[model samples]
Target chain A: MKTLYIILAVFFLILSAIFSYLPLGTIALIPISFAFLFSYLVFKKSETPNNKFSKILLILTIVCLIFVLVKVFFIKNELEIDTKFEQQKIENNKDAKKDLEDLENDLE
Target chain B: MKKTLLILVLFFLVTSFKSDTENPVKSGESLVYSGSYNMSGLLTQIAQVNMTTEKVTTAKNNYLHFSCSLATYSKWDSFFKIRDVYESYVNPISLKPSLYKRNINEGGFIKKEKYVIKGSKVNSTVSFKNNQETQNSFTIGTNTVDVITFLYQMRTVNFANFKVGQTKSFTIVFDEKEMDISLKYMGKETINAGNLGKKECYKVSIAAKTAALKGKDKNIIWLTADEHKIPALIQFSIPVGVGNLTLKSATGI
Candidate 1:
């Protein structure tokens, strides 16, 4: 039924929008494709065959697809060096070295 | 019950007399991995893991330092940042750990733990986010090792002699607790290791004696069947979904 297709389209559209904004990267494309499929089905089953809801769903699907594609290609997953963590590492190493010396003396 | 007791005794006896295997990993060896999580059948990288080894010399002794660090990528840092480092200082030839340190900062929670292993006893110090500290000492099995050392020790194991379905067990001190973990050999398989091409690797499934690691035979690791024996792939079951680590680069083998 056209109503069922519209409902599925809306559901998938929401999921695609949410996933696109999250750090899940290109995974949003899955929901976007499903939204597009359901939106096409809704349009085909509609009596007028030019329903505004179907058009809106299709547009949203394209927006989400484009957003995810831009994120996948442009966003680089790089690690930012933490200076505080580096300092903590140095301190831990220093303390460990001293402890090792004391331990060796105790063993001897 | 009597059979179980006898089997346990025999297992202990066998493990006690086993000598150290030849060292396959050397100092300055570094391996970088991309830790990803499976979401909707798509793998999304979450963290960058780096495992490195270094030779450290003190006034009295020389030790091998095995350091493993995990840090979330820039994008994930905003949502749930994790900067964790686990290190083990061990004897170069025997791989017997002397000191183990873990400093983890996940989200906003922070904790630090250190253990000094001497003979058959371990001295532990744990500090929490509130600056509360606890120190304890306990006795352990002679062959008990820390997590980082246990990971490096796996490379020294001779998998060629192991039969399929054979399990090798180890007692590892993690989070100030002694855990019995076993690795079941699942035979050799060639997997496509990124940047290293196709490598023949020994597939082994890991089982832990704790509820933290759920599912049977779901956690598996693949190690390169070579002198270096670097870990090529690791797959484990997580609460949300399955997580895996793929070897991105290896150097100084």
Candidate 2:
């Protein structure tokens, strides 16, 4: 049962890492992180046969949780740049029109 | 312990799949931006045409107004013959829900012989002659030739199925003859239009085997890089040189 718990915790941790890039994935990391922490706590209390493995899985889970949080925050800048690029495009159009009109009169 | 672990694994898997559904923009929503185009070409028998157009629009509708002058430098005359400028305004109203009342106004100079025909001084009048509607077609025109051509072109676009990367191929039959045409999806690109900042646009290219104004070799148009898919740029090769038309500028108000 302890081994099963360790395996499950590792599985959730991997899933969390895969989804860390997506917005909704950040929320998902919470439950998986808790499961890893809880399993570690439970396994630590008992004299489990795979105690070393449980410790490794617990460490991995913590690393994934931290990685996910960092990724979610890092994404903000990229989204902001995309927004600004769109705004610049609109402004450029307005200026081009004005210049063209002026050029039209100059040619005449 | 096993049950708790299994539950946790299942929870994470389900949550990962859910992230794919979130999108920032919704369908049927409109976004507006400004666009500019520069084109240089020759107008058969006439002087070289270097035109620039600017445009503004929401995702669904667009207004393009352009003014251009022709510059002629002939070997025989030596002196440049620059004509009085002409301007045109085009508002491509998006018929998203359905066709609505729209207006098209065009006034320009056409040089004939040695006289520069001024559009304002000439007997040029803007009038609405026909307003007819069928099940899938609508026609409004003060000019019969222009209106008929507009209506025929409108029927070719399958608005119901138009989407990104979708290609529409058809033949336009005018005066009982078929003109093979193919409009291909050129995807999206970001272009910086001089003073205009930058624009994200879905580029579409239209090619025809033969066009009314010129033969098949010179008929190509780049449509508006927005959701409306209006023709923002048009270029055609003529017998003498080439003619290019662009959306210079627009005023929504």
Candidate 3:
């Protein structure tokens, strides 16, 4: 189990480092931090499970995750807004208004 | 406890020998649905879908050819025109698709895909309007069916055998990946089916999320409550409102 934990930790660590250079790179921090917590808990039976190197890696991962969360919540992108749906709503309202007018004219 | 376990095992063994049901897709028949896409209850666009099956002779053998086409009413063509056609050549007995083709023209972005299945393998080819072509191959089970074929298969199924609240799931390997479908039977209801008027229908909810359009919403389908099991209405949630395709007329009885 200890070896398996080490393998998973190393795999996720490499994957996180690689993906951190791509688009939405900050998302990679999630897996890295999750892997750190999981590996530490599972391998805590070992004498040096909380070694300085592992502790520092876990801290860095958490810091990166915090930074990403803050940036995503605070930053806004105008282009990401769904303007197409808004346009459709406006068009549908116009059609409804026309239909109502035709109904009123028929009643008159 | 041991005696009861033995009896349970014996019961399962006996039930495991049940016979398979026959395929229910009839040749030379078709289904048509016509409805409008309303934005927040305001009618904005209209859509019509037609699916038909016929006997055709392919190069290698004779097969039942199924064709389904979806077209937006010409009035709404200026807004968002969609002309999609799906064709599948299926085994007359097994009802498995031997060859399938899809031609889609949505919002002027055109794409074409073809699948040729032989025994346990399928070869897929896709081409875009921009002249990019990709070819791939995949292994599939003998009972594999494409999306269009799956719809017709659903129509032919004996829903009465399944209890209400029962969910049927199928995984289809297409477009290079497996897509999971979960269809739940939601009891009987009477719905106004456009020109068809009010009819007894079996309500089924397809829990496929409409994430691309807007908030997560399930696609609801109402099948005519008879052996034919025709679809009365299909409602989809979009970014703004619900889009429905209701059955208006019928043919090929």
Q: Show how many residue pairs clash in every candidate, following the order shown.
A: 0, 11, 0
Tens-digit per-residue lDDT, B59-143, candidate 1: 9899999999999998899889999999999999999999999999999899999898898889999998989899999988999
Q: B45 in model 3: Cα distance from truth in Å?
A: 3.0
C-alpha positional error of residue B247 in candidate 3 after TM-score superposition, expressed in Å: 0.5
Per-residue lDDT tens digits for candidate 2, residues B1-253, read 9999999999999966553112111222222222112123211122333332334443343444333333332311223223322333233232111111112211222221111112211112222325332222223222212222232233335333456657666443332234555665656666442223355544555565553445542445554344344344455665544555544332221
Q: What are the Cα lDDT values of the candidates?
A: 0.89, 0.40, 0.66
Return the DockQ of model 3: 0.01
Please give the ranking of all candidate structures by DockQ, highest first, separated by commas. 1, 3, 2
Collision pairs in model 3:
none
**Tens digits of per-residue lDDT for model 2, A3-59:** 666666666767766545333324546655666776676567658666676677677
Q: Residue B250 in candidate 3 has what lDDT? A: 56
Better of 1 and 2 by DockQ: 1
Stretches of candidate 3 exceeding 4 Å from the true structure: A1-108, B1-22, B194-197, B209-217, B238-240
Highest lDDT, which number?
1
Give stretches of model 2 more than 4 Å off.
A1-108, B1-166, B170-180, B192-197, B211-218
Q: Can you give the lDDT of residue A18 in candidate 3?
A: 49
> Residues A8-40, candidate 3, lDDT per residue (tens digit)?
766666665543433232445556676677556
